[model samples]
Target chain A: MRHTLRETWTGLRRNLTMTIAVIVTMWVSLSLFGAALLANQQVDLVKGKWYDKIEVSVFLCVPNVEGGQCTSGDGATQAQKDNIRKVLEANPQVQEVYYESKHEAYEEYQRVYRDSPVKDVLTESTIQDSFRVKLSDPQQYLGVVEQAKSLPGVQAVLDLHPVLDPLFMWLNALKWGTLGMSVLLLVAAALQIGNTIRMAAFSRRRELGIMRLVGASNAYILTPFLLESLVAGLIGGLLASGTLALGVYFIIIRKAATSITTIMWIGWHQAFLAMAAVLVVSILLSVLPAFAATRRYLKV
Target chain B: MITFDNVTKIYEGQAKPALRGVNVDIDKGEFVFLVGQSGSGKSTFIRLILREYRPTKGIIYVAGKDLSTLHSWKVPALRRQIGTVFQDFRLLPGKTVYENVAFALQVIGRPTREIKKVVPETLDLVGLSGKGKRMPDELSGGEQQRVAVARAFVNRPKILIADEPTGNLDPATSVGIMKLLDRINRTGTTVIMATHDSTIVDQMRRRVIELDAGAVVRDQREGVYGTA
Candidate 1:
C-alpha cells in the first residue's frame, strides 16, 4: 500500500499539467452538477411557497350599478353573497375563506398601487367585492372554480394558476437547462479523466515492463494509476461541493433570499444532498474510466 | 529446471513460424547460452519459457508447471520464479539505484525491513554497494546493467533469463558483465543468456545452444560461439 501510494504520487507529479487539467475539468463538471441540483431545489422551494399561498378569487357584482353582472343589473345582494360563501365553506377542498368587501378592496388597491397613477381613478363603487378561497390541495383548484361558477352572485371565478403557471414554467425550464448542460460536461469530464489516465499509463510503459518482469501482479501495476485518478477526482469533487455551498450561501441566501423574502429558499439540508450527489458522480466518473483504461491500456 | 517439448510458435498473419519443433532441457544450477543471429528465435524461446506467449503447438514445463495450461492470473507467479533482464536495462529513470533494486522486492510484497536488508546485499553482489543513491542516467552503461542484474537477482529467482544483457556495452564493459553473470551462475542459479557476443561466448566455456532459421542447429557442451 505504501509503495502504491508513493508510485501514485510520483505518477501524478510526473504529469503535473495533465493532472491539473483533469482536476480542473472534474471541478467544473461537478460544480455544474451541484449548481443544477441547487437550482432544482430552489425551484421546488419557490413552487411550494407560491403554490400554497395561491388563492382562487371569486368576484361578486357591484350593487346599484348599471351593467353589473347580477340579474338585477345593480349588483349581488347580501343574500347572494352569503349563499356563495356557504357554498365555498362547505367544499371539502377549501382550507380557508376570506371575504373582502368593496370598500376593503378599494382600500387595498389604493395602498398596493399607491405609486401608480391608476390609483387616482379607482373608487369603492368601481371596485368589486370577492371571496378568496384557499384550497387543501392547491392543484385541485378546478373543482372549486367549477363550483363557484354556478353561484348566484359570482361575477367571475378567477384562479391565480394562469398568472403563476408561466413563471414557474420558465423556472422549471431553467432548472432542466442547467441539468442538461451538466450531463454534457460530465461526459467531457469522463473522457478527460480516461485520457489523462491513458497518458499516464503510456508514459510509464517502460517501468511497467520492468515491474511485470519482476513478478508484479496486474493489480499491483494498475493500482497506482487508479489511485492517481481517484485522488484527482476526490479533490475536484470536494472543491466543487465547497464552491456550491459558498455559491448558495452568498448568492441565494445573502442576495436572493433578501430580495424575495416572501419565497422560501433552500437551506443547508439541500446543499448537503447536492454535495453527496456530486461526490458520487465524481467517483464514478473517475473510477470507471481509470479502471477500464488500465484494463485495456496497461496490459501489464 | 526448464524443458521445451516439440514447441512451435507461429504468430498471427505470418507465413513463417518463429520457432519450429524445438526441444531442449536445462537442469537445475546449470548455465546455458542461446547463441543466434537476429530473428533466429532466441527471443521467442525466452518468451516461451517466461510464458509471455504460448506455443502454437506442443508444451513447455518450467519448475514443473505446463506453460500451455497456466492460468493468465498465475502468469505473475510463474514469472516470479524467473527473473529477466533486457538489452535496454529497463529501469525506472525517476528512481535511484536503491529504489530500482528494491522495487523488485516491493512489487512482490516484501516487507520494507527485508527489502532494506536484501537490496544492499544484492547491489554488493553486483559490485554496486555504495552506488545505490545514483540515478540511472548518472551511471555508466555497465553500472546501469549492473543495477538491472541486481534488481533481477534480488528476489533470488531460480532462473535468470538475460536477453542480450551486454548488447549495448563496449567490449570491456561487456566482459565485465559476462564475468558478473558467470559469478551469479556459480552461486547455483540457472542462467539462460541469449547473446551473439562471440568473444564472451568463447571465454565463458559454458553450454551453448545455437539456433538458425528458427531451429536449433547445434547443441555443444563447453562450446565456443562458432558451429560445433
Candidate 2:
C-alpha cells in the first residue's frame, strides 16, 4: 500500500500537466452538470409555486356586456350564478370553487392598485363577479375552460395558464438545454480522462513491465493509476461543489430572494442534491475510464 | 524445478514456430545456461517460464505445477514463485536501489517490517550493501544489473530466470554478474539464464542447453561454449 501510494504520487507529479488538464476538464463538466441540476430544481420550484396559484377565472356577466350572457336585463341573476357554480362543483377535475362578488373584485383591485394611478378610477359597479375554479391538476385547465366558455351568464372563461405557460415553457427549455450541454461535456470529460490515463500508462510502461515481472497482479498494477484519477476527480468534485455554492449564494439566495419575495426559490437542499450529483458524476467519469485504460495495458 | 515437454510456440501472424518439440528439465538448485544466436528462441524460452507467453503446443511445469492448466487469475501466484531479470536491467529509474528491491516484496503484500529486513539482506547478497540509496542512473552498468538481481532474489523465489542478464555490460561486468548468479544458485535457488555470452558459459562449466532454429541442439553437463 505504501508503495502504491508513493508510486501514485510520483506518477502524478511526473505527469503534472496532463493531470491538471484532467482536473480542469472534470471541474468544468461537473460544474455544468451542477448547473443543469440547479436549473431542473428551479423549474420544479417555479412549477410548484405557480401551479398552486393558477386558477380558472369564470367571469360572470357585467352590466354592459353584449351577447345575452344574462337572462335578466343588465347582469347575471342569482339563479344563473347558482347554476354555473353547480356545474363546476360537479366536475371531477375541479378541486375547489370560490365565488367573488363584484364588491370583492373591486376590493382586490383597490388593494392591488393602491399605489397605482388607476386606483381612483376602479369601483364596485364597474367590476365583474367571478368564480375562481381550482383544478386538481393545473395542467387540465383547458377542460374546465371549455366546459364553462358557453355557459349562461358567463362573460368569459379566463385561464391564467396562457399568461404563465410561455414563461414555464421557456424555463423548461432552458433546463433541457443545460441538460443537453452537460451530457456533451460529460462525454468530453470521459474521453479526456481516458486519454490522460492512457498517456500515464504509456509513459510508465517500463515501470509496469517491471511490476509485471515482479509478479504484481493486474489489480496491483492498476491501483496507482486508479488512485491518480480518483484524486483528480475528487478535487474536481470539490471545486464544482464550491462553484455551485457560489452560484446559489450570489444568484438565488442573495439576488432572487431579495428581489422576488413572493415566489419560493430552491433552497440549500437542492444545492446539496446538485453537489451530490456532481460527486457521483465526477467519480463515474474518472474511475470508469481509468479502469478501462489500465485494463488494456495490464493485459498479459 | 522446471520442465518443458514438447513445447511448441507459434506467435501470431508468423509462419515459423519459435520453438518446436522442445524437451528439457532442471531439478531444484541446478544452474543451466541457455545459449543461442539471435532468433534462436532463447527469449521465447525465458518468456514461457515466466508465463509471459503461452506455448501453442504441449505444457510447461514449474515447481511441479502445470502452467498450461493454471487459472488466469492464479498466474500471478505462479509468477510469484519465479523471478525474472531482463537484458535491460529493468529497474525503476525514479526509485533507489533499495526501493527497487523492496518493490518486489511490496507487490506481493509483504509487511513493511518484512520488507525492511529482507530488502537489505538481498541487497547485501547481490553485493550492493552500501549503495542501496543510489538510483539506477547514478550507478554503473554492473551496479544497475546487481540491483535488478537483488530485486529478483529479494522475494526468495524458487526459480530465477535471467534473459541475457549481462547483454549490455562489458566483459568484466558480465563476469561479475555471472558470479552473482552463480552465488544465487549456490543458495538452492534454480537459475536458468538465456544468453549468447559463450565466454561466461565456457567459464561457468555448468549444464548448457543450446537451441538452434527452435530446437535444442545440445544438452550437456559441464559443457564448453562450442560443439564439445
Candidate 3:
C-alpha cells in the first residue's frame, strides 16, 4: 500500500495538470448527481414531515344560488355545507377546519380578479362558501375526503397531494436525470482514467521493458500505474466533497432551508450521505481503471 | 547460465524471420558482445533473453527457466536479475538521477531504509554520487547514461545487457560509458553489450559474436571489430 501511494504521488506530480483535470471532471459530475439525489430525497422528505400539515378544500353547496343542481362544477347547498362541517367535526382524521363564507370567498375572488372582467361577475351573493379541512394524519386523508364528499352540502373534496402532483413529477424527473447523467459520466471518468494510465504506460514503455528484463514482478510494473488511478480518484473525490458541501451550504441550507422552513427540508444529513456515495464511486472508478489498464497493457 | 538452442523467431505474417536458427551460450560472469547492423538479429538475441517474444521453434534457457515454457507474469522476475541499459538512457525524465537508480530497488519493493543506503552506494559506483539530485534533462548525455548504468547495476543483477548504451554519445562519452560497463563486469556481473559501435567493440576486444543478415558469421575471444 505504501509503495502504491508513493508511486501514485510520483505519477501525480509528473502530471499535475492532468491530475487536476481528472479531479474536476469527477467532482463536477458526482456533485451534480449528489445534488440531484439530495433534491429528490428532499422532496420525499417534504412529504414525510409535512404531508400531515396538508389540508383538504371542501367546496360547500351555495344552496342553488345560480339555480343549477349540485354537480362537479356547481355551487353547494346550505344543507351540504352544514352536513360536511358536522361530518368533519365528528371524524377523528380531521384536525381542524376553516370556513370561508360566500362574502369572504367573493371578496377573495374579486381580489384575485380585481383587474379583470371576472371581478364584475364575482359578488357576495354569487360566491360559494368552502371548508378547509386539516388532517391529523396524512394517510387518513382519504377517509375524511370520502366522508366530506358524501355529506349533504359538499360539492368537492380535494386533497393537496394531487394538487402538487405536477410539482412532484418535475422533481422526480430532476432526480432520475441526475442519476442517469452521473452514471454516464462515471463511465466517462473511468475511460479517462484508463486513457491517462495508458499514456503513462506508453511513455514509460522503455523503462517498463527494462524492469521486466530485470525480473521485476508484474505487480512491480503495475504499482505506478495503479497508484496514478487512485490518486486521480482521491483528488476527484476531494473536489466532489468540497463542491457538494458548497452546493448544500449555499443553495440547500441557506436558500432551500429558509424557503422550506414553512414546508419540509431534507437538511444536511442526506447531503453528507450523498457526498459519501460520491467518494466511494470516485475510489472505485479510480481503482478499476488502473487495475484493468495495467492488466491489459502491461504483461509483466 | 544461458543457452539459445536452435531458436527461431518469426513475427506473425512476416516475410523474414527476426531471428533464425540461432544458438549461443555464455557462462556466468563472462562479458560478451553481439555486434550487428540494424535488422541483423543482435536485438533479437536481447529480446529473446527478455522474453518479449518466444521462439517459434527450439528453446532458450536462462537460469534454467525455459523461455518457451515461462508464463508471462514470471518474465519480469526473470528480467530483474538480468539488468538492461538502453541507447536512449531511459531515465525517467521527471525523476532525479537518485530516483532513477533507486527505481530498480523500488521495482522489487525493497524497504525504504535499504533503498536509502543502496541508492547512494550504487550512484557512487557509477561515478554519479554527487550528481544524484540532477534530473535526466539537467545531466549531460554521458551523465544520463551513467545514471542508467547505476539503475541497471543497483540491484547487483547477475547479468547486465547494455544495448547500445553509448549509441547516442560522442567517442569520448562512449569510451567513458564503455569503461563503466567494464568496471561492473570486473565485479563479476556478466555483461552482454549489443552494439553497432566498431570503435569500442574493437577497443574492448572481449569475446565478440558478429551477426550478418540475421546470422552469426563470427564468434571470437580476444576479438577485433570487423569491417562489415
Candidate 4:
C-alpha cells in the first residue's frame, strides 16, 4: 500500500500539468451538473407553488364598458352577478367560486401594481367585479371558462394558463439548457482524464515493464494509475460541492428567496443532494476513463 | 524444469511462424544457452517460458504447469517463479540501485523486513553492495546490467531467463555477468540465456540449442559457439 501510494504521488507529480487539467475540467463540469440539478428542483418548486393557486377570473360588465362583452353600457346589477355565480357553481369542473367586489379588485390592483404608473389610473368604479373560480383540476379550466363566458353579466373570462405557460416554458428551457451544457462538459472532462492517464502511462512505461518482469500483477501495476485519477477526481468533486453550496447560498437563498417570497426555493438539503450527485458523477468521470486508458496503454 | 512439446508460434498478421514445431526438455539446475541469429526465435522461446505469449500450436510446460492451459490471471503467479532480464537492462531511471532491486521484491508483496534483509544481500551477491545509492545514469553499462541482474534474482526465482543481458556490455563486463549467472546456477536455480555473443558461449562450454528459421538445427550436450 505504501509503495502504491508513493508511486501514485510520483505519477501525479510527474504529470502535474495533465493532472491539473483533469481536475479543473472535472470541477467546472461537475459544478455545471450540480447547478443543472438545482435548476430542475427550482422549476419544480415554482410550478408547485403557483399551480396550486391558479384560478380563472370571470369579470362582470361595468358602466360604460367598451368593446365586445359589455354591450349593455351599464354596470351589472346584483341579480346579474348572482346569476353568473350560480352558473359557475353549477359546473362540475369548478371547485369553488368567490365573488370579488369592484372595491376588492381595485385594492388588489393597487397592492400588486403599487410601484407602477397604471395603479394611479385605476379607481374602484373603474374596476370590474369578478367571480374567482377555482377548478378541481387546473388543466380542466377551459370547461369552466366557456360556461362563465356565456353567463348573463360576464364580460370576459381569463384562464391564467396563458399567463403562466410562457413563464413555465422559460423555466423549463433554462433547466434543460443547463443540463445539456453540463453533459457536454462532462464528456470533455472524461476525455481529458483519458488523455492524462495515457500520458502518465507512457511516461512510466519503463517502470511498468520492470514491474511486469518482476511478476507484478495487473492490479498491482494499475493501482497507482487508478489512485492518481481517484485523487484528482476527489479533489474536483470537493471543489464542485463547495461551488454548489456557495451558489445556492448566494443566488437562491440570499437573492431569489429574499426577493421572491411567494415561491419556495431549494434549501441546503437539496443543495446537499445535488452536491452528492456531483461527487459521484465526478468520480465516475475520472475513474472510468482512467481505467479504460490504462487498459489500452498499460499492457500489464 | 521446462518442456516444449511441438511448440509453434505465429504472430498475428504474419505469414511465417516465429517458432516451428519443436520439442525440447530441460531439467532443474541446468544452465542452457540459446544461440541464433536475429529473428531465429530465440526471443520467442524465452517469451513462451515467461507466458508473455501463447503458442499458436502445441504446449509448453514450465515448473510442471502447462503454459497453454494456464489461466490469464495465473500468468503473474507463474512469472513470480521466473525472473526475466532484457538486452536494454530495463531499470527505473529515477530509482537508485537499491530501490530498483527492492522494487522487484516489493511488487511480489514481500514483507519490508525481509526486503530489507534480502536486497542488500542480493546486491552484494551481484557485486553492487556499496553502490546501492547510485542511479542508473551514474553507472556504467555493465553496472546497470548488474543492477538488472540483482533485481531479477532478488526474489530467488526457480528459473532466470536472460535475453541478451550482456548485449550492451564489453567482453570483460559480459564475462563478469556470466560468472554471476554461473554462481547463481550452482545454487540450483535454472538459468537460460539467449545470446549472439559467440566468445562467451565458447568460453562457457554449456548445453547449447541452435535455431535456424524458427526450427532447431542443432542441440549439443557440451558445445562451442559453432561446429568445430
Q: Which candidate has the highest TM-score of all?
A: 4
Tens digits of per-residue lDDT, candidate 1, A1-300, equal 988899999988988888888888889878888888887776665554324565698888775443324675578888998999998999999998888887887877664444344667868887888888899988788999999988877788878576767767776787788778778877877787778877877777777888788788988998888888898889889999999899878987679767875545666778898999999988888899889888888775
TM match of model 1 to true structure: 0.76
lDDT of 4 by residue, B62-118 (tens): 999998999987888999999888889988988899999999988988999999999
Please, what are the lDDT tens digits per residue for candidate 2 over residues B41-109? 998998898888889999999898888988777888888889888889888888898998998888878
Among residues 3 or more apart in sequence or in different chains, the pairs in candidate 4 whose N, CA or C atoms overlap within 3 Å are none
lDDT of 3 by residue, A1-300 (tens): 677677668788877777777887788788777878787776766554324455787776554443223564456655656776787888988888788877877766654343333458656876777788788886677888777767665666678786666767888888888888888888888888877887778877877775665567877668778777787787788788888888878987689767755545555677788888888888888898779888878766
Ranking by TM-score: 4, 2, 1, 3
Query: Roughly what TM-score does model 4 have, to 2 decimal places?
Result: 0.81
Error of 2 at A36 (Å): 1.6
Candidate with more favorable, higher DockQ: 2 or 3: 2
lDDT of 2: 0.85
**Which residues of candidate 2, in runs, are more than 4 Å off?**
A48-143, A146-160
TM-score of candidate 3 on Cα atoms, chains taken together: 0.66
Q: Please state the error at residue A37 of candidate 4 in Å.
A: 0.7
- Per-candidate Cα RMSD to the true structure, in Å, reads 9.8, 8.4, 12.0, 8.9
- Fnat of each candidate: 0.76, 0.68, 0.79, 0.71
- How far out, in Å, is residue B29 in model 3? 3.0
Question: Mind sharing the TM-score for model 2?
Answer: 0.79
